[model samples]
Target: MTPAETRTAGTTPAYAKGRQRREEIVTAAASVYADAGYHGASLRAIAKRVGISHATLIYYFPDREALLAAVLERRDEEDDARGFPREPVGIGGVRHLLALAAHNARHPGIVELYVRLAAEAITPEHPAHDYFTRHYRDARDYMHSAFSAMAEGGHLREGVDPRTAAVSFIALMDGLQVQWLTNPDAVDLVSPLRFFLQQVLTTSLDQALSRQS
Candidate 1:
């Protein structure tokens, strides 16, 4: 059986309790890391937030890096559960991203964590560097496929390159997040993204219609 299946099959009461405790620790750690950032967040602080001692916290995650990794993994899992693109395919994928931005508007903490960690993870030695690297690679690939599908459907403009468009779209989303985080009152997130999508897709559709006319 697969490792996942094996784990499922072998789960006992003890295993279940351990998983529960681990999830509690991760949830608490996420908040601490979000508030303090990875560099500023301490194991003792997280432990305090979780109402556990440092030694108990260490029992679940042997090191700070391991705890950070678990927090990131948990975030990804939660995002996926919230419909954050298991795969990229069509206009729905673009819509999903916009929806995510709207959802993020309500959760400044999560947004702060993502923006801060993503910027910090640019360093090669950072614990989350590899995570961010794989994240961007996968996100770009999915978006590229989505754009390619749009092109295939005759919804893309004649001169638009799917690969370039995909990259630009991701960059725009990240840039907007940074701007919005910096000044929420001054910068609107979802509106600009919606405007961009309308401009890009509607222009493409118009071009396609013009060709047929």
Candidate 2:
């Protein structure tokens, strides 16, 4: 989108109200979807949560597919808002993810929803299969670039391959989520990630995060 267009987005009263209504519906839908998986969530339920009529909800999202897509899009927007950049910059990328994990710790329902949907979307025919595919691919590549940058800058540990570390880190996050879901009180999500990064990088996670701040 053009910068000029972005600056004008949702500026008018009617357009802003429409956009606000859409965001409200998406937020409510996300909550409902988090409580109940997409298959179990219904438009009526989402509309009720948003205090809107079913017809109004349909007006905003023509169908279940559209609403589900919006929920996923809003989720990525939330992640971006949480500081998980689309293109992570060096070790700071790792720092952002760890910060995200910390954020996730306070929201187990969101973490559970993510884990559930990621598993559900493994099938080729799943509506979000492509989304998950690109999501993981982006995650892997994000970390790969970070590790690669560290290697070039002499911050990566000796004998560590960026590709391998990147893949392993993603796997670790997925596994940690599963464990944390089952034992939220016992598990320490952010620290495990911090430890993993410490093993791979010569720079302290704190030092890098502070620089980002």
Q: Identify the leading candidate in terms of lDDT.
A: 2
What's model 1's lDDT at 135?
90
Per-residue lDDT over 1-213 for candidate 1, one digit per residue giving the tens place of the 0 to 100 score:
544554644322136677888888888888887787899888899889878899998887878998898888888888789766576677767766777888889998898888889888999999999999999988888788878887788777678888998898888888988898889898887877666655567355334323421
CA lDDT of every candidate: 0.79, 0.83
What's the TM-score of every candidate structure? Answer: 0.85, 0.83
Clash pairs, candidate 2, are none
Residue lDDT tens for model 2, 24-136: 99888878877787887888999999898999998877788888898898889877787664667577777778877888899888887898888878899989899999999
Q: Candidate 1 regions off by >4 Å? A: 1-15, 203-213
For model 2, the local distance difference test gives: 0.83
As a TM-score, model 1 comes out at: 0.85
